[model samples]
Each structure stands twice: as structure tokens, then as C-alpha cells.
Target: MTQPNILELAKQGDAKAIALLLNRQLQPKGITATAALKDGCLQVILEAVEVPSQQVLAAYMSKSIAGLGAASIEKVKVYGRQTGTKVPAWNQEFEMAGQKLPVADVSETRSAISTEVTESKPLSLKERAKLGDVEAIASLLNIPLRNKGISATASLQDGCLQVMLEGDPVPEEELAVRVVRRELTSLKAGAIASVKVYGQQVGEDFPAWNREFEIVAQTQTVKQNNNVKLNNHNHTLGDSIESDGLQEIAKNGDLNAIAILIQKSLAAYEVHVDAEIQYGVMLWLKLKSDKTLDSQACLNRVSRILNNIQPDKIVSARISQINSKNPKQQAWNKYLAFKEGQFIDNTKAVNQMTGAFCAAVVIVLIFISVMYKPTSTTSSSPASSSSTPASSSTSNSTTPRTFLGKSQTGYELWADKNCVYVKGMTEGDLARLNTDVWRFKDEVKLQTGYKCVLFE
Candidate 1:
């Protein structure tokens, strides 16, 4: 269809037609209706004319409004970060300063007020690199506790740490924000890493300043000692200890310490670990105790993370045994022993297990294919069958051959013989069909396949 006609149809709430027009216009420009939808103009139109918010569908159409209306947004100070329902499609009605407002309205208000504003906290090298401020983040690292006096500013240069004083004076402060990028296993001494100084202002008092530093670590840095001391004086495991400046503690089978350390390390960055740190801690304990499985730990961790984080961030992992003494292997061994004690042969059970494993593999492959598909298979496919049956002679002769598909009544599917039988009709189609409701004026006996046959 033409651009003007498409725009008109969109204004009339024909989402599919609007989408079609948008796609046609954007295809030549190497874009999709999804792209137009991202910019918000088309999406706002669709939403205003359409019934509900089509944000997800708008995203599908590529109509994103990134940084759109961000400048005029205001902050809605949340208490303890527990602002609203954590569930998706969740809604709550509450009184806000004596006015009742829906949670969705609150969310929309929040979004509109804080457009394009990121939640990046201020980090200063001078405060972090202080004599006792080991919690300071040189770049953008998370610290377990808050830095009360930590002060620094950062700026993105040719992508390196650049240090400056708070008052924009000299290079007195040696605290630098440096970015380091390397594989975890290859980290060693004398590695040149990329970094950035975040010299943004905080509150209304402090001016913008930057402090930069660089790590001398190199790729392929071997762990010479088992007791390694972290930069913040935290004693770590697998370190033999250092004699001069720092000390490392050694332990054997201390499950509590091991669990705590594993939890702390794993949970340090939420973005990195797929499993909860608590789960990691439990898994570590199970491994240390030579237990059969970490299922209990896994479930506990899942519960904790689910309670803590928003619904969108919840994730799961499927672990497999790579070692002979792997936990899963041990679990299977225990299961076999228990069954044997009960005088039951595990051969049949093992065969069933094998069948399940094969089925699981096939399911995983199919799931991956669907997830990685180029186009969305979740959306409705185009209708190929027309309602204008070639043999329906009593149907409105003057009306266009537009098909109004079947009508669904609960579990029962109903289709008018004249409309070629379909389920559920769109509002537009319903309105048109209502005008033709008088056409089947007389009752007629229909074949078993037909709802009712009309007699002239």
C-alpha cells in the first residue's frame, strides 16, 4: 500500500496494515517497522489508536525511542529500592500522597520523568585509593560497602584513565580510573589494559574532576602462591601466602569459609554469574563435603535471587559433570545403591534414563533453533483461507470478499457457514458482520459440518 494510505489505516487502528506500510517504507532504507516503532512516533500513534500498550510489539516493529524525552524526566525517590511489584504484568493499586494510582501508572510516570538518565554512580580515585579506602572502585567496579569520603570524577578520553583534582587544579591525586580488559585465565603482571575516568559531578557541591591509574598486570599471569592477598587486604583461597606486604590464610575442609567466600566472589557482580552466589556456595559445599548433589543449594539460591531481583533478571543454568567424581555422578551412584538395597534392578531405570537424555537433547536443539530464528515465530501468521466460500450463494453478494474467521465460544469453536467458519473476529470485522446478521433470517437445516442451513 501507499504511504498516505498506510498512515491513514494506522490512524484508523489497523495495526497490521500500519505495520505493513511501515515495513515497506523502511525496507528500502535497510530498516524495519520495528525501527520506526523504536523512535516512538509510530508506536505512540499505534498505542493512542489501539486498545492497550503495544510496547513489546512496537519493539518487534523496531520502533524504539531510546533517549526519547529523557531530558525532561524527574527522579521519583524510591525507598530501599522496593518501589513496586517485582513481577512482570503485575499491577498494584495504592494511595500515593492521598491519591490512588496504579503501579503501571507509577512506572510510566517514573519512566517519563527520568528519560535517558542512567544509574551510574560517581567514582573517584582519590577517595578509593586512600590509605584505608580499599573499597574504592578505580573505574566502575562494585564495592561491598559505601565509600563515605571517596571522591573522584571520571571522563571518557581516547579510552584511558586521566586523573585531575576535585577543584580542577593539578595532578596531585594519583587515584586513576583505568579500564582493564582481559581473559580471566590469562591475567598476569605487566598487562596494558584499557580504562576510563568517570569525572561526573555529584550532588550540587562537588565540581567535575578525574583521577586515573593503570594496572601493571599482564595476560597469562601465573599464580605463584596459593594464598593471594587482594588489593583491599582481603585474604583469598588457593594462595600460598606472601611474606612481605600482605598475608594469606590457609585452611582445610573449612566448608563455612569456603561457602562464604564462594558466595561473596560469585555474587560480587550480578551481571556475570548466572547462578546465585548462594547456590554457588552450596555447590562448593557439596563438592567439598563429597555430597551427591547440589539440588537443594540450587533451589535455595534460585529462591533467594528471585526474591531479591526483578523478574526480568532471573536466570537458570543446566550443569553437567565433567569429572569422574562429579556431583551428578555421585548422585547417580547413590541412587543406584539405594535401589539395589531395595532389591530392584536399575537396568530398566538406566534404560529409561538414556531415553530421557536423548529426548532432552532433541528438545534443547529445537528450543535453540526457535530462540535463534531470524524472525519471530511467536506472532500470528497471515491468514491464507478466505471466508468467501465459492459455494455460499446466500452470503451478502454486494459486500467485499473479506473473511471474518471463526467464532470461539468457550471450548467450542463456532463458525457461521456463510462466513466460512472461524474463531474470534476483529472489531472492524465484527461491526461489518453485524450488518449482515439479518441475512440468515430463516432457519434452515445444515449438514453436520455446518452450524445452521438457511432456507430462502
Candidate 2:
């Protein structure tokens, strides 16, 4: 008997029939596919002795849904766990049948499925949000935020998911980030600049791990917005500090150096620093400017320098000159985060700082990094590890931000210069096709939080 097309059933939100059809191949391997519709996502649960990895199952299912050619069915949530566990330990959201697969590794997903047999379980609110399910995202955030008496709305804009908190006694930017990062981890994000995610694992337990694989995909060079103006005043470039040296230290996650660099970099504008504080990825710089400047405009400059130095680092740089009457003296400044060569107007930055006169001192003392340069020399640029700053990074500033491409579909890869390249090189042979020399190799250890942001 000819079974109904899974795509059509999925589009109609018929979770049961879809599960029945999916179970045909899945069930034989001791993995049952039970699906349900939640917030427009088809939530598929796989229960077994042990759940398969989230990335692999999502990729496997992504290939399936994408091949079916259904536009109506846009989201899929696959959860895997022990056969009888109430909570699914494995869960990942797969944005499916679209121009791109949201899975971490496009090349791997495009390849054959893993031979390992595994099952899935129910999707949690956090998992549902990964597929751009607004309700799930909102529901997951609404409770805690409400308890804190903050009114907020969460949404997906331009492939980015963010939460907007309104009303009085707004939570500290650091606290807010903690909530977001801890609450909906599957929906983690940094700023975007034609960025794609790669090198992500299938899940906690799926076994198609190519412990020995490296992919470097590149595509056409593209131009981006360079709106921020740069004017070097007082012309003491080399005298201050080796911007290069400070940058090297910042790459090693020196929070102190990051603040000093920001202060010194803005000194040319007569923007004197007051207090600077960072809560997770959110950074607030309270300043006293003798010259009038728009908040966003100042942020644009800060964003540029930070991006130039850090590349893909996520720091919501809130440039606030206004001393809020609010007692806590929070950094209720306009939030502009640096990502992919620009300052993005991201979520509001919140923090507290006590400052008003450190710019002159900052500039004079900046060059002292020459004194603090670590004694041990490891030439590689630090991979954005917040914990161990000076470890495991192979590339430097020129390194093309390695993305295990969540947005990419194994169709194209490119440098920020938009230099395009194809993948056909052997396991170890690499050649520079573009004159803009970027570190290229066959291996990178991917992490969860900092450098490797796994998202679509």
C-alpha cells in the first residue's frame, strides 16, 4: 500500500499520521517517532534505551523534510532520551525544508545518516523555540521575567531571536543575559554579519561524530556597512599602547584590558570614561563627553574598533553619557552590540558603574600591556574561551570566523571579503586562493558558548 506523503501530512499539522509514517523506518531500528504540533513546530519524540544525538537526528530529519519539498512545514523539533524518561535529555530545533538547513554542519547533514540506532522524546519549551517558535520562546522567558516584574515580548527578526523587556525596575543587563543564556540555551545568539554556524555536534549522544574532519567553505566576497566615521586626533598613534598587543591580551579574555582599550580608543573624541562594567556578553561604558555625540553614533565607532580587533565576539556596548535619575544608576543606555564588522542595535544593555574621569589616565597607562604580556608564547589567536583565555585557538584577527554553518546549506562558503572557494582539497593540503591571507587548516575544536555559537 502506498503511504501518504509525509510532507503533506506535516504541513496539515497532522502529527499522528506523520509520526506513523516516520515510524516505519524508525521503529524497525528500536527508535519510535512520536510527533506533535506545538507553536507551528512539528515536535518529534524519539524514546529508546538511549537517545541519539540532537544534531545528527536533526540533520537526518532535516534531509528528510528538505527532500520532501514542503514549504508549509517550516519547523521541526526532535527530542531524544531514554525510552521511558519523562524528560528528553536530547533536543534540537531544526528549521526545515527552507533555503537552508538550521543544522550545525551542512556538509555532515548532506552526507549519509549514522548507522547507530537511537530514539527521541518530548520537546521542551526551550527546544521548540530553536525552530523560531515564538510562543515557546516567550513562554520560557515570560515566567521568570514576570516574577521579576518585568514586562517583555520575544520575537524573531531577520533570523535573529530576541526578547524585549519593558517597564520599571528593568533587570540588570547582566542579569538579563544570564536569564537568556541559561533559560533558552538552544536559542543562543550573537550578532550576525552574513554569519553561519558549523562544527556543532549532533546532540548529547548521536554517534556520527567524525572525530577527524575539517571543512572550510567560502563564497563570493560581499561589502558591508561602514558608516562609523574615524578621525585620529592629537596624532599619538604609536605612543599610546600597542593596539596590537592590547588586542592580543583581549583575545585572551582580559576583561580589564577590554575596558582600557575602549577608554583609550575613544579618548580621541574627548570622551572621558566614567565607569565600565561587563555582565556576560553585555558591556556598558559610562562616559562624559565634552563633545556632543549621538549614542548610536558613539557606539558605531566603539563597535568598529572592537569588531576590528575581536572579529566575531559578542559585546553589547552600551554608550551612556546620561546619568539616570534612577537610584541604581543603571546603564540604561542605547544598546549596540559588535558583531561581524559592525555595531548592531541589539537588546537593551543594563548595568551599574561609578565613573567620570579615567580617560587621560587610561591612555597613558594603556601601552603598559608590553609589561603584562604573558611570559609564555603561544602564537595562535585565543579562541573565545571565557574560562581559559590563552588556550586552543589556531587563527588570529585575519582568520575567517570559522562557522559550522547553521545557515549554510552546503551550497556555498565565502570569506567576509566575500572571496568564494569550493571544497575539494585533500585532508591536509590547503592553498590561499585570495590575497587576504587568513589562517586555514583542517582542525578546530568547537565549544558551546563563546567562539562556536551554534545557531541559524
List per-prediction Cα lDDT, in the order shown: 0.27, 0.45
* Candidate 2 C-alpha lDDT tens digits along 1-456: 122232344445555545654554554454556666766677877754456566666667766655544455678788887543468887887776445643322112323343643335355434455556766566555544544554445666565554565434434443444344334432343221121111112232322211111111211121223432445455333334342234433433345546666666665455555445566665666766444455555665565445434421345666666433432232225567543323566633221111111222233344563565444346544544233322222233343433323212232222233323323322112112210111121111111122221111
Q: Compute each candidate's TM-score over C-alphas.
A: 0.17, 0.25
- Candidate 1, number of clashes: 53
Please, what are the lDDT tens digits per residue for candidate 1 over residues 1-456? 112232333434333334344433322222222112222223312211012223333332222122122221111111111111122232211111322222222111333223322223342222233222222222222210012123433233343433222323322222212111111111222222344333433343543543334443321111222322212224432231111101100011122222333333323112111122234322212222232233333323323222121111112222221123432222211011111011122333544554455445446656875686554244434442335454342232333333333233221132343533222222233233321222211111121245443211
Q: lDDT of model 2 at residue 276?
A: 51
Instruction: Evaluate model 2: give its TM-score.
Output: 0.25
